[model samples]
Target: MATGVMWSLCLLVCFLIGAARSESRALQKLDTGGGAENARAPPGPARALSAPSIAHDGRLVACSGKYLLGFEPNGSFAWIVPLGHMCNDSISPVFEGEQVYLVAEDKVIKVTPRNVHTAEPALEVFFSHNTTSGRSEEIIGLAISGSYSSLFLTIRNRGLFTFSLHGELQWSVGPALNLFDYHLGCKRNVSGCYFDSAPVLDQCEGALYISNTEGQLYSLYVDNRGIRWIQDLGSHGKVMTIAPGNSACLYIVFPRKSIVVGIDVSTGSISWTQNIGPISIEKNLPTVDSNGWMSIGSLDGTLYSISPDGDMRKFLAKTANDSVIHVGPILDCSGFSMYVAKTIVEGKLIQTVGDYTYVLAKKPSFILFTLLAPATGTVYWTGEYPGELSNLLSSSDLNDFTIDETVVLTLLSAAKTGISNTTQCYTRRQKIACICRQAKAKFVQADPGEPSYVLLLIFLLVVIVIQAVAILFCCIFWRKKRLQDNGLQKFLEKRRSLHSKRRILGKKILELEQRAAEDASSNEALGQLGEMVKVKEGVERKLYESYSLGRDEPSLEQQGSSLPLYHDKYRSHSFHSSQKESITIFNMLSDTSSSEDGTSSCSDDSESCSGTSSGEMELDESKSAEEAGPSNTANVEEGVQHELEKQHQHCSAP
Candidate 1:
């Protein structure tokens, strides 16, 4: 029983492995030209990293490692070209009139796609370059201008090279703009930048616009002018996509700056700049519609439609797990109409025209191609891609694409035919009614002020007026404050001047008081001397009068004779009194005059008078030494008193 159980388990494991392998095989198949319900997978070789490019003859060209494979519309291999080495990610085919040009590392090969039915296709070796001339470097971009009949090839660090249509080297420019350091042995960016996108052709201006990892946009004039201008757009990763506006402007996107700059094609002048979000990868280039609205994708699952004038309309796709949109958004056949899908899986807008839009997306983690209404973005039917589709291409951009009226008419007829099932019919009716309801909501006349737009406008006007008034008042206040500050400065200066004057006055008063004190001390000493001299003089005059009275009888007869002598003595006394009066007037005038003037003169007078008095006293002492001691002394004393009293009166009258 144990052996049987182990064998049963082993068989179950083998069956599960077989089922997974078969499912993978089924997923790898292709659908050919069968109907959507009865489509089957085609047997084709494995693919590589190369993406599909639409050829001039409506064929799909792709590079599988070292080989170039061309596929038919029904998803079958049409032709194959074996390259000498594995092609780099930058390798791409530039389709011209009859020949397709393919650039592999150091060489470019030319071949005609019409000759695929032959036993073995012949590819002409168009051109080859060595490592030094720059062509030998890894190729980063390829482009062709049929109008100018020239080819442009971009290689790492080797600027831009122009060639004839037949691959004849015209002129090569060095040190091409790249994301990495253009000079050798420079360590700036470890990732190493290069040209990652194809060059876009401006047929009208006869120039080619391309960008490099060095964050530069270059316009190469194919003629003798060479490089027209180089605009430093800032570094962008591998997703540098350039889109053209209607006639004048060329739009270049910078994913790192999350911006798109519009440059004039002829003059290379910047026209406008816009800020989009962090852009999605280079899965699709910027798509412009007839109305000049561009559709751009962001990594955050947001789709933005920008107008030529820099107006943007945005929509976000809701997803369950990882809503990062690695693929950029592509425009549909209709102008601004977009059919977007949102769910737990991936979705793509395959085709859209007017009301009918198709979405090749996954629902609930399962692949489903849904038909939706364009106006309302409502899903109508969900189906599969018939066979496992690795990639899908719209034929509108192909050179040989021709619209078939019959196919369009058939699709119209099928859409008009109603679904038979009740559940499906009900769902379809509900989706169709969605747009009508939206239209009714938009067009139905609203109540005059349901949104209070008038009130809002009035409120905005009032706010603006208030702001203006506040600004005016602020200006007036500022002006007044400035004037006030100026006046305050002047007032402070005046106050300082007044304070200085007060300080000077106080200093003068202090000096006057000091001098007055000195003058008071000197005057007190003079007053004391004058008092002593007056007392001595009064004593001498009284003694003289008493002596005269005692001798009156004896001199009665001599009195008449001495009368003249007395008259002379009286006259001398009057003269002395007059001199004293003059001295008194001078002293009074000096005291009323300035202290500086009074002190200067008074000092000289006081010294002179004191010296004279001391000399007179010395003379009197000598005279007393020569005469009768007491009598002579008395006479000398009396004479000295009289002289000292006169001198004291002159010096100390004030």
Candidate 2:
């Protein structure tokens, strides 16, 4: 359990350390955004004024002055048509099946390819119409019915005109009603009308929606060419563009008013008005999706999405270079199985003309070509051009331009050094796909190592810590348990058992051996040395010798002898031979006697020798006793008597 806990702790620490390191690596990657963007740089063309139109066959049709070019998705030209005259600047080409319509200054020509599937097919004029002849009657906008039967045209300073597909004039509405009269507090002079925006035909309701510069939005019932209703937008607040809604309502944007008004198409009455704050410049026409999301871009470089309920969201902030977002936001489908349901648009302007100062370099260029993401409004890839942008064209422009859903395109002005009034094309979806593939590859390569390294480090550290803690706990617990038992005492007993038993026993035996050896030596010494004297039975000898410090004196009391004196054979051992022996006691009682000689001589009969020696010794003793005091003489007399008795007993018995 302890080991497991330690391992867990170690793993945790490793994880933390790895996380910190990975965080650092991630920060390093943060600085690589610029490089990543460079790796997927957008494609560039000379210039373009507006989005390119997609034909029904998935081809992109772009206009460059009198030349109309059809391009494949790779930007390769599929076919080109020279119109012999300049194309209308404000309007785009209308495509229907294999047939395309070009609106020129004074004529409308329908061009068709012999074989659209061929690499470069033969093209010829299918029809032609002299729509107008007046010099000032230039066509500014054009629209075609969804059924490809009716064509709607908006001419400059002229009213709205409708015609059949066969070039027959159907009906015309002109001079929008005057609702702005300055004389009346409630009105202003907006009656000087001119049509600039394109006409919109609603097949569902059999109505056409058109607005003029004179501030009137006319909703005409198309069936009888009768007026449904007219809504005055006030003064120069002409509608810039109109976006039809999901229900009976439609949305219209006014450049001058900087607002979008929602109108009830059934009654031609405004349902709601949303104000867009003051911007750097004009805003593009709004685009509404099937969902109630309306996307619009401003010259201030911001893009906004407003819902039908009037709730607005600023989806994208101003771009990096402060370029005007001339092309309104678009929601492009990724078309990938994984992200099929996910709507992601791609690309936006890289550099922008900023802070206009009325100078050539500082002047606003109005050239923006980008693919936008619908989810976050992020630009994934960009297509570059040098021409002014007119407007954004998408598949939604199919009603008017006959664009196919498969061909996602944008058109821009291509005018450059010597080229004037030319245009270019961009495959927006292709560019977006390129960006996605490149970025994904790079990200996939970068992700694996850093995170794995972090996790491995974390696991190792956790294991190490857990193991250490477990070991430590085990050590402590064991020590405590040992102390709780008789560990100390047992340890001491074990130490004693480890001692040398043989050495201890040997010491004890050596001590006993030493004692025995001493005893044996003493016994031998005693056995070797005989007693000092050995006597044969029958007779025994007693020797006595007396000495005094002073010289001998003759006195009556000294004549008595107290102790017995006898000459001994060992008398030479008592003193040297030259020195005379001095006797303090006198007695003559001994079995053994010696004459006046230095050496001892033993005799079998001792009577004669003893009598002589006894007489001499007695005389010497009496003289020594006379020198002693009366009490000394008495003690001498008793000691002489006892000595004589001992000598008699020794001589008489064994």
Candidate 3:
């Protein structure tokens, strides 16, 4: 599990390194933003930005002020698109499929990464809000429909809006939430008749859920283009978050009341509602674990776990009033919980007497990170870091270090007790490997930014490429070994055939030993046996020049009127087998499996044995087939007829 999270982090780190590689030499003199963004940020204030989105291919896309930028996965800029109007620095750009949707002042712009060079990157306005002359009409939230062909957004007090993904306005609904606007001190008859929350899609039932300030929930159909249902909970507060619940319901959180309600996705009916406790901040949203228990945070410095049936259990993270539970609980797939809290500490920003211009807050805070046991909320470990983090929600730094723990990475841009304008980066690993960035200079100077992240990407890329190449070569080598074994099988069969013929020749020459003096047929038999002996000798010599293919080829003497060599063959022991070792492909698969030679060599067992490898046997059979054949048979018969006449004439002279 840690390995899986490491790869995901490697992807994020690699893409960030890719962006840093495109930084110009002049960019080093400024802050760490790109392009038209350098003017918005100086050497200080590292927060002028939009939320960056990582594509499936690992490219990072984000917007700064009025421009959209793209970075490749291997460290280079792909394209940049400019929007004429300014964009909200707080709003995050949404990437759906291959396109990007982001807010630009009063318009929602769609960008296509592929056609950035050929055409305008901001292809069209997906939706545009008609603004009232004096009031602000910024988009509150943006989400894409499950079909990936539609978009939904909530304009502050104006209501809910929907559009086709390709720049077509489908429909709009003005919520009836403004009846009690006087309670919140809104003007008598302005454009904001109702305050609406962003639309959240529940993919299970094909519906979108949204809430008004009066606690009224509206269910809208995604495909048929109409309002499905609406229900009011009879409470008044800001709808802080809306989440898709376990199969049957949709969960909504109201931070003012600290109430979490589960609304049925189909009928907009409230099934279960429970108030955990009052939360001091709105960042404490709820998260559901693997077993369907939802966990949330409260001002009491406690983590609360609520089951789907509305049973609530609380575990104390700190003594009440000692620490602030600023963020909610986060659960991995295995039900391990992560909770964040902080305690306000009274300390000055400056630690030394030297002249320092970068003054910090009088009460700088310290953050607390706790890893809790699954479902029990038992503390596994707590990490405390200096400096303040607004909330841990949606932090890209969230990563798994073990099956149940995570590595904590903290970056301090503004130091309260260090040299002026210095930045500190700290990492704590839990069963994971990490590289720390070290800087020795006391004063803030222009150092090469993102050096450690670049080194990490370079190292990971090199290792993965080498492992792939090693596996490929191993496959090729084994394939060649299989083919050599097949040729050896054919060579062994040929050796067996020649040895059986040798046994038959010895038997015939013995039978005709007496008949050579008495009959003509015996003379012919004597001639054929002599020719067979010579053919076997030539083949065995050519094939097994280095090792014996069979016992040394037989020697036949043409002493007059005799098969005398056959008569004395049993006494001489001429067919003894040679012993020689052979080289093998793999030592583990030694040559013990080789077929033994035929029966010509042994006087007792009548079976010869020799040590020859698969490679040597293959070589011997191919050479013998090419050189020895049927032409030698016809010549041997003519020699036998001439010799018979000389014996007959010598008898007549006697």
Give the number of the best model, judged by lDDT: 3
| TM-score for candidate 1, residues paired by index | 0.45
RMSD of each: 30.2, 43.4, 25.3
lDDT of 2 by residue, 1-654 (tens): 999999999999987787666544433322221112122212222223234665656566766556566655434446656667766645678765567777765667677754544576444443344445544666666666645477777776667777787767888867543335413111344344576667776544567887766567778766446677777776426446787654455777765556777777778777788866323233245666434456776544556666655667664353423444444443333311000011122332333243221211234433434554433444444433322222123212212222211123232211111111221223433433343343333434444235655777899999999999888866654454323464656534533322322233234334533553365223222211111111100011111001111222232222111132224211111111223333221222244653333323333265665455545554454444334334433443354346555755887996
- Model 3 stretches astray by more than 4 angstroms: 1-43, 50-63, 67-82, 113-124, 134-136, 156-158, 176-192, 236-240, 280-282, 289-291, 319-321, 328-365, 371-382, 387-654
My TM-score estimates for the predictions, one after another, are 0.45, 0.43, 0.45
Clashes of 3: 2
Q: How many Å off is the CA of 347 in candidate 2? A: 21
For all candidates in order, the CA lDDT equals 0.49, 0.47, 0.50
Error at 513, model 1, angstroms: 99
lDDT-best of 1 and 3: 3
Write down the worst ten-residue block by lDDT for model 3. 431-440
Model 1 segments more than 4 A misplaced: 1-46, 119-121, 132-136, 175-197, 235-239, 282-284, 315-324, 329-654
